[model samples]
Target chain A: MPVNHSRQKRGIAISPKNNSPVSLFFEGAKDTFPLIVGAIPFGIIFGTLAATAGLSFGATMGMSLFVFAGASQFVCVSLVTAGVAWPMIVLTTFVVNLRHMLYGATMVFFYKNLNPLWKMVLAFGLTDETFAVAVSRYSKNDGVPGKHYYNLGSMVFMYGNWNLCTFIGLTAGKAFPGISQWGLDFAMPATFIGIVIPYLVSKPMWASVITAGTVSILAGGLPHKLGLMMAALAGVAAGVICEKVFSEKKERI
Target chain B: MFETGIQLYEIYMVAGMALVTFGIRYIMFPLSGRLRFPELFERGLRYVPPVVLTAIIVPSVLMPTGETLNLKLNNPYLIGAITACAVGGLFKNLLLTIVVSMAVFLGAQWAFAMGW
Candidate 1:
């Protein structure tokens, strides 16, 4: 007779832990390498641009390491270079990274049952790539990926990618080799376009996009670069109102 | 060089910057503690992305001359970016979206270089 062991139990289907800590730390560097190949050049450009924009290498690296979002960092450096005040810099960063707030709200549904440390670490480790991966994994037919390890690995990889590439770019991110005549600066707007396209997945999403675009257009000239703040607030306001109205109507029906 | 009045230490400023960033990120941490946000607040939060993303990217697309308006006739980046958006919504693929938009940007810039 074949021996069938019914003793083993799967707790939420994550994984059997094997040398968890060391593995988690390096996993970030390894898995994110493919993404990093593209990201590094971008990081290098941000660093080089930041250097030209008058940030110290330490500050540049610190911002890249600690924060890890590209558009917001670019806006922060650009605005500072343009001589916007300190408060405006802080506000701009908030406005730009505000999207992550949405990511947090959605993740709470999946992660609420996790321990405090997991919640805190997941919150801290939140980034575009990690969140995108984690949320999809959490929502799919299969359960979340080795929840802690997957995110930890991706975060670590991304952190190394951003910092190291930034250092390299700072040292040697010349426009000459890439052929400045080629208009490589479009990478940013192009990237934003890439993100925005994925988001037109629903009615509310579409509403948010139009609202964000319109308000941003209207508030484009706010002083101290406050236009961005207004745009963010306006976009959120429009979408929220529409959603509320839609839901209320559905309930009434 | 004036290095005295009103200036902060380098390390302190770095810490301050990091603190400010973390503070902004942690703002969403309270979501759990509140069993429910003000009904209005919850609804609005749902719509935040579209509004904010538009605000973030529109200027990049439309405002090349700083404050002046440059439409399809003048700036090619805007045209390419818009096409990329259409491609993205239609195709629903990141790779295709990136490739299409990037090609638009490069092609337009190249044409400009060749003076065509």
Candidate 2:
């Protein structure tokens, strides 16, 4: 059967000796720690800003625990403060998070062999930070046995960091009202730069990054983060076209 | 105990945001795993992380307030991002990049405040 063929191919590729789930999990956690450092200020800013925006402690923390996405949470808080209606808030958050769909698509190739429960758990835990690290690992090893545990480690650690920081910010934000403006937020873009720079090894890749970043800045004023979604699509399209053209030229030569 | 008129409604909004956020995250894996994407489409997905991430990161720096592009010398964020990108490209170390970037950002902000 096609399922068996797929399973056998992936199963054979796994380095069984390297299947140390616990160590892999901790390694994932360790690797993700630096990213967590960046996220601390992000979560704190969200909590503090949400409180000042008139959200109750319970509501602010609830959003962090439940929504878990940083950008959307910030957007939700601002829109809520502006007295935007609930549907609009929901729609805006959803649009802002559509990039996750692309992440899921990229990961599904490696995740397909997993059982439903594992799929559900990892899917729930997936974030931009975890996905960036996890996808790199999966891309490196098509069949690293117990690879999902690494992603689990990253996700669980990030989830914990986000929640704890939110609590700290909510309770202590008044004492340090200027904490958000302390420029700790620089960690995020820096973290992202570190993540993206490693992938810039090809013409199509460089083209995609430059185009996406430029489009995002130019379209920054778009309503509800549609610019981000638009830039992602444009970048992907540009990458695909560039890949085809460049490959054809190389072949002709 | 300030009484905001929307306190009661915030709960529902929070729930709605949670549902939509989780729903988006949960929607794709199962379907994509079972289906077959065309060769070109599959190849393109490999570029998704860098492209989408840069798309998110760039605006956060250049347009921190989301209203205007601040390419000015006083913009610590732009300076910090450039510093971080250079460090990341040169060293490929996440922690050092963050640490140095924040240091530079704080230093630049301080200098700007001092009218330098």
Best by TM-score: 2
The candidate maximizing lDDT is 2
Real contacts recovered, all predictions: 0.47, 0.78
Flag regions of model 1 displaced more than 4 Å.
Answer: A1-41, A79-106, A128-133, A136-150, A174-182, A244-253, B1-8
The lowest-lDDT stretch of 10 consecutive residues in candidate 2 chain A is: A10-19
Q: What lDDT score goes with residue B57 in model 1? A: 63
DockQ of each: 0.39, 0.63
Q: Give chain A TM for each model in order.
A: 0.67, 0.90
The stretch of ten residues in a row with the least summed lDDT in candidate 2 chain B is: B1-10
Write candidate 2's Cα lDDT for A128-234 as tens digits: 99999898888774545778888999999999999998888788887888887776777778788878988999999999889999999888788878989889988
